[model samples]
Target: MSKIVLYWHPMSSATPIACALAELGVPHERVKVDIHAGEQRKPAYLALNPNGKVPTLTVDGAPMFEALAIHLWLAGQYGVERGLWPAEGTPERLQAMAWSTWSYVTYGAQLVRLQTARDMGTPDDPHGQAGHKAMDELLALLDQRLASQPWMLGANYSMVDLIVGSVIGYSAYIGAPVQKHPHVLAWLGKVQARPAMQIDA
Candidate 1:
């Protein structure tokens, strides 16, 4: 087994990775980087992740960063055997990859914008409005996808649901209009109810 070490902080973007680790039952070391204390910018942590971000994982001492990349890699590497990830080269795998990327690139981007607007106390501004609209449309798309299914990749809850659901759950927590989409809200509730999602990491 490869020795894995996770560098993370509490309640930040790294939480999802921690949750994934828990779900996979992967035994690893955890190093808490206090971002509030600016430990992330220190030279040692920067050596692992030049972006100076948490959620950096070192597998056999080789470092990898970014929550999306880490999640996908974890699912591919460990999730297949556990049924958390779809097998490669299949339609379900393709959908999993697509939705996973969409969660980060598409929905996550708009969520950041909305968060920025709110942080600036300008949620009613044009940029904020645009972000809100984009989020609504994205959530509607997710809603439609879930209208007939309970999970993102269909009947079973897989890593795809966890990946996308984490972002959607965070959006709702940060005051996104996720409540407007009933299917999404319901699906998110299911995701959150998982024991892995309940881990405080």
Candidate 2:
């Protein structure tokens, strides 16, 4: 087995990758990067991830950063038999890719904007309000999607759910209003209930 080392922080977006690795039952080492302490800015860390983000996974010395990339790579490397990812060339695989991209590019962007507004102490500002509105629409869409399926890809909990749920969890932590979307909330609850998720938490 290739040696795997995951550099992460407890509160960072890296949470989902950690959960995915745990769920896949892959053997790996966890190295916590203290972002709050400015550890991510260190020269050595920046060499691995120029973006200076947490959850950079090194597989036998090759570095992979970004939460979504790490999840996809790990799933490809170790999760096929476990079914954490859709099989190659399957329709479900396309769905997985689409949903994961939506999670990061659409829903995640708005949530990040809201978080930025809050960090700037302007949660009620125009930018913040726009972020909130965008998030509301996205969450509603997710709720509608979940009304017909148990998970993001379908009845099974696949990599898409892990990746999407992590970003939504981050949004919730940053105070995105989740009360109006009961189905989404319920699906999140199920995702959060997983033992691997608990370990990541």
Judged by lDDT, which candidate is best?
Answer: 1
Residue-level lDDT tens digits of model 1 in 1-201: 899899999999899999999999899999999999999999999999999988899999999999999999999999999999999889999999999999999999999899999999998899888999999999999999999998998899998988998999999887789999999988899899999999978
lDDT of each: 0.93, 0.86
lDDT by residue for model 2 (38-145), tens: 999999999999999898999899998988888878877776788788888999888888888898888888987898899999998999999999999999999999
Where's the lowest-lDDT run of ten residues in candidate 1?
168-177
Which window of ten consecutive residues has the lowest lDDT sum in model 2?
71-80
lDDT for model 1 comes to: 0.93
CA shift of 167, model 1, Å = 0.3
Error of 1 at 162 (Å): 0.7
Backbone clashes under 3 angstroms, per model: 0, 0
